[model samples]
Target: MSALLDQPLLWLVVTLGAYRLGLWLRDRTGAHPLAQPVLVAIVLVATLVVLTDVDYASYADDTALITFVLGPATVALAVPLHRQLARLRGFVLPLLTAVTAGAVVSVTAAVGLVRLLGGDELLARSMAPKATTTPVAIAVSDTLGGLPPLTAAVTITAGILGAVAGPSVLSLLRIHDHRARGLAVGSASHGIGTGRMIVDHPVEGAFSGLAMGLTALATSLVAPLLVALML
Candidate 1:
């Protein structure tokens, strides 16, 4: 019953099972962009949480193990990056410029759109870091006097959107350069998009992992200054 639903182990199993189902669906669907495994898993987990009436706070706490694993997972992206170190060095200057520009544009567009839509300053601030990774976005939102949890949700949504449609969009634009594509996706979508790139294209994923880290640093510096001016 309620007590059974509260077990951390049960939730962990449920989370993994949901992801497994998502993977199966993705394979069955021929790996369509819309069939993204994480997106599917999110949908499945959300449905289950609502059905079980489990509060988000308890669910998150119960699933803390997964959160801890994310740190190492992020660090592991370095393996592929290390393999690209030689090429990375040659592109350092351009990559830095691209990431910084992307960070500025992302913050400006998010904050501007929110304000234009009549959202208050608090909401606009919360939306400012939506393009960055979750932890960085949450921290930036908190520091800007906005709600961290709201920023986290928005950040994840943004990431999912980028992962689902970014590659196709690049293809449409005739952007075939893997480096450029990776930089664009990682700068705009953070870890989730980078994860997609990692699975679909290894070289792109290496550059994407590089961009994700750089975007975090760039956003951290750019957000405060940019938001201050806009607000």
Candidate 2:
């Protein structure tokens, strides 16, 4: 059992299986608000690791394979974006304006919440880019002298929450425009929310891709500057 668990592939299998189980449960529960698959998967995997006495480092080493796919997945979003180039070109100014606002707001809100909750500088910085996708958020956190692993975890949590509850919130606010909904979700929730928007509508998908890319670029630049200024 020990030898089998020691294999790198074991972690890959375990993580995937846990995620599938999480998804199954979420579906079974009719997509309950608190039954977020990623969140559930994390709990499941963490419990398993604790029960088996497996080190986080060993688990992370194998999970890097899954993390590495995020880059390609982000790039794949460009296909729908390309098809909607003309529409994007039309509203460039408003999109840029909104993306800029979202970037700054995301950073401030996350950092502010952490500080309000009595977190220190490192924790604040780690949460600073929570609205961005995992890859970019990790990089931004590292640049801001934050813990990359912690940032990755926070970013994923934010994404999962946004993907699950964002639409309802938007509907409550009477935001029915597909483009507006997509941009809002993508800017604040990153890739996961963007993926959901893509399944809902093409315009939403395009705007989401645009918002995600632009917000990532903006956040990458803005976060470091903000941290430096505050420091």
Candidate 3:
């Protein structure tokens, strides 16, 4: 074990191996409703970290190569958006309204709830952009004097919760419009919910991709201003 830990490359191989195992489980289970691959991977990794008594920083160091891919993966979302450009043009106003409204509600509600519960300024700020993607969320948190790590954790939690419950919530609300559903999911959940959307509704998936990109851009521009005003 000490030898494996000493060789950082071994750690990388093991982490990727675990990730692939999780993905294979996702597929083998037919991506079952309960078999969330991200959740599975998180559980697996967490368990391994705990059992091996490996600190998160050490594990993260080994996985930096995988983490580095996130930037390009996020940028790749553009392909789906570009493919749906025509539909996007027609629904521009509605999409903008939905995304803007969702972002405002999500941020405001999170901050308000935390504050009402006696959370400190940092906690409130961290919750401010929990619905946005990691990069935007981290920026927002920093501008607001929040802890970036807390914001990142909140963003991941929000994404996971959204991915798990978004479709059911829409169903309960009787929301049949694919475009509206897609916009809401993307604006609220970011990438994880977008994954579930892609499997359930291709059109919604495309629209969600567009929404995620647009919302990230909008939040990155607006969040700092909002934080400045509030503070």
TM-score of each: 0.97, 0.87, 0.91
Model 1: residue 231 alpha-carbon error in angstroms: 0.6
By summed lDDT, the worst window of 10 consecutive residues in model 2 runs over: 30-39
RMSD of 2: 2.4
List of clashing residue pairs for candidate 3:
none
Which has the greatest TM-score?
1
Cα lDDT listed for each candidate? 0.90, 0.85, 0.80
lDDT of 2 by residue, 120-155 (tens): 999998988888878889888988989999998888
Evaluated with lDDT, which candidate comes out highest? 1
* Candidate 3 residue lDDT tens string, 63-90: 8998899889877877776776777667
Cα deviation of 21 in candidate 3 (Å)? 3.0
Q: Which ten residues in a row have the lowest lDDT in candidate 1?
A: 83-92
Error of 1 at 134 (Å): 0.2
Q: How far is 47's C-alpha from truth in model 1 (Å)?
A: 0.5
Q: Listing every candidate in turn, what is its Cα RMSD in Å to the true structure after a full C-alpha superposition? A: 1.1, 2.4, 1.9
Clashing pairs in 1: none
Q: List the residue pairs that clash in candidate 2.
A: none
Tens-digit per-residue lDDT, 1-231, candidate 1: 987996778888888888888789878988789888889889989999999888988888888999999999999999998887877757888999889999999999988999999999999999999888899899999999999989999999999999999999999999998889999999989999998898778889999998999999999999999999999
| Stretches > 4 Å off in candidate 3 | 228-231
Residue 37 shift from truth in candidate 3, angstroms: 1.1
lDDT of 2 at 71: 76
